[model samples]
Target: MKNIVILFALIGLLVSCSDEFLEKEPFGELTDGQVELPENIESLVISAYSILNGQGNEASNAFNSPASNWSFGDVLSDDAYKGGGGTGDQNQIHRMEIYNIDGQIIDVVQKWSVLYEGVYRANTVLKALKNTTDFDEATKTQRVAEMRFLRGHFYFELKKLYNRISYTDEDGNYLSNTQITPEEIWTKIEEDFNAAIAVLPETQADPGRPTKYAAWAYLSKTYLYQGKWQLASDAADEVISKGGYSLTPNFSEIFIPENDNGEEVVFAIQYSINDGSPSNYNGSIGDRLMPPGGPRYPAYGFLRPSQNLVNAYKTDVDGMPILGNVDLTETDNVDPRLDVTIGRPGIPYKDLGINYEESWARDLATYGPYGPKKRVISANHPDYLPSWPYVTAANYSIIRYADVLLWKAEAEIELGNLEEGRTYINMVRERAKTGCYIQNLEGTANAANYMIDTYNDPFDSKEEATIALRTERRLEMAHEGHRFFDLVRWGIAADVINTYLEKEKIARGFLTGATFVAGKHEYMPIPQSQIDAGGKDESGNPLTTQNPGY
Candidate 1:
């Protein structure tokens, strides 16, 4: 990030050039003192938020550093597949899906680059705030709080994806990656959120801006990641008891473009289309490759739902998750969320009035026959861009109310409060059971055997409660990009993912060599380019070190 921001000073230095430089105001041509002006400071803060979609004034290359983390989060997990033309299409991602990942991969470098770019932008705003004077004191404090909130978010992503990233702040303090511990990095993340919480307003006129409740939600998540059970639970309780967020009536309705900023969303990346931009830069540029190729939604098909995730949704006669081996290829009584989350062969997809068929999926022989349905706006909607590089205006929520409920549940279970945990789990289940489910093509019949029920009774023990909690989280949060991380955080990544690859390879032959190594694969290998460029040590080695087993 420091390398990318090349600040230059001019003393009327000029080079004669062609007459095609737009003949307009140059981008970021401000002097250092002018950058600290009140208006420019406000623009810089907005600039920090602009990177949330992971685009940087370009129309392409978004797949490399999508803020959604679809590549690292969903494709790396058992939840989805690298479903494009074949194994060779975007083959780097194929290498990731098969666990042949290398530190030299583009995703490793670009994702790291974009996140640090976010940190740099946030710090730039903070630095400008520290020097500006004409700004109102109250508003200055709020903007400072907002920048810290964003910096915390960026560092949180860095901490989870990279584990031990270099840390820097507005006051010019820089801690090398080798010099900082993951625990210290986590502490820094918490400090930023605490600073934000101390000054932010309870609400904002602009829906995308963080509120006090948003900071609390993020803090709860940070504590949950660190296993601070009591602190995590308390922070979640603050949101639940005081935050005015709620679940929308229908499970499927929450994702449509109309509800992008609906009640359930706590913090989201704002996106829009047809807002007078030369391209769909303000749209879901990162997720352009995700739309399933169908008559209604015509686009590249990537991130197909894995059959393992489909099997996880199967229910028994009592609407409880079937813990035993149910045929991974077939479906029986299942939760309604399965249809809402994934597009299967015979289901009526959205409001298109046609059934999703095996023909709709690309590279079906390699990736199998399923497409992601959640967070995918209907092709007929105005928010979808129909031209080349199809994108959408639908927003992506970084934190949602459902996530808060589940965090509290997990903390409760870990703290030995099984009944309290079950109650929270039941709340999520009850919404799926009673909410709007997938209807038939004509809207006259039911789709699949929708048989979902809540956990109305007590669990026999903590082990049983823990299993229930994890399963409910998977079902409720499918394809929203929380599957693999959930498994890793619980320390069962090796067991669960290896078991998945074993069973799934039998159905899809392409997964023959995929493996998940516990100590090494828990976090991605640090980008080799970063290590090479990250200064030097006394022994002439790169200062930044790689994660274990890299």
Candidate 2:
């Protein structure tokens, strides 16, 4: 949390509209004393939730700080390309795509800023709630709990992306970046979530508010990241057994605007396309660059799926993954999720009238022809906006039920509970098997040799189960922005990415010498600007030390 968090608040509102309200200073604003009222303080809690979508009051490019993590998570991984007009369009991302990211990059700066803004807002609520007198005791505690949940979320993202980030709360708001140890940062994140879980309700009247299970799901993920296998599995079990969430039967329907907060979503950043903010800032603005150009929906065709990702879908006769040398030629069978996840050359684009053609892609020569599908709302839907800012009311889920189930599987496998893990993995696979299959232009038959099946269980070695679990997670969460961090945590980033580059270079020449350096490239550097402004240590050096090679 920073000392610069605004102290004023308006009653009964919390969102992008509040961005405008918060910007108004001195004239026609409530006094700092007036803001201590119960309703105004409650409004502060809601305002904390607004920053989750990555838009600050400024009109700067929100795509650079996209809550979707498309640029850092997907493009930096083997899953996507910095797709658009050419290599020069949003070139900072191009440098990021090739693993040549620098501390001065716009994304490096803005992402750090936006996440800290979230922290600031959350801490503001926590600080203000402590002073309010008229608010109901239980309600105040509930608001405090929600703020902690949100604060925990922001720090979790920072830890994952930067590895060792500064930790803060209202109590120690101005602590230097190096004040906490790496282990202490994780402990702080756990503390926030654990505190929230003790008070947050199982259900909220508002869909946007995270419930107890949401905190538990995140705690499970936090433990998984740190390799606390038993704790991770136990946390995941709490969500699975008690959260009452299920896999949305139709995988394709999950991303649709109407189902944005459906049963599958454990917690999500709620986005509203026409939310009365003149600029549509409350919409998923950070992902504004993702909509692929086509006859029906025209927008920047960025976040293009990579050829390597498409090939990973290839399956053998038993509907199992065929690891290396995945031959996409000869009508080879591929997982059905491939069609549900990526818009290929011949598939009907999200059930819109026209088929996806090569012309739909902005640069066929450079990025190749595969537009991302998971986050894209159908052009035919009413929420569709054929313009800027993540363009739809479709909420970006921070944690999905399937994701929690997989976390359990991953933890179980790591904990040597192979059979239990296999069952959990199969639950997600079973949904894909029976739920949906991509159909042809007329919606007559399977689009591509769709052949996906569940894995055979029992007595399999941890190695085989681990492979199956990792493959399932990649296929399920491909473009929603979890791939790169997953690879890094598994300690296989260097091997996986270098191999991907070696083969991928044959098709996309831009990746000729790209390499994922072991210790350094796993985490992005602390922004140069942050280091300059973050004050100094006792020895007259910058307080924030740069991550390894940076």
After superposition on all C-alphas, the RMSD of every candidate to the true structure, in Å, is: 5.4, 4.1
Summarize candidate 1's per-residue lDDT along 168-225 as a digit string, tens digits: 8887677778888899999999999999999999888888789999999999999999
Model 2 spans with C-alpha error above 4 angstroms:
1-31
The TM-score of predicted model 2 comes to 0.94
Could you tell me every candidate's TM-score relative to the true structure? Answer: 0.94, 0.94
| Segments in model 1 whose C-alpha atoms lie over 4 Å from true places | 1-27, 57-59, 328-331, 539-541
Lowest summed lDDT over 10 consecutive residues: which window, candidate 1? 1-10
Instruction: Evaluate residue 50 in candidate 2 and report its C-alpha lDDT on the 0 to 100 scale.
Output: 75
Evaluate all candidate structures by whole-model CA lDDT and list the values in order.
0.82, 0.82
Error of 2 at 448 (Å): 1.7
Relative to the true structure, candidate 1 reaches a TM of 0.94
lDDT of 1: 0.82
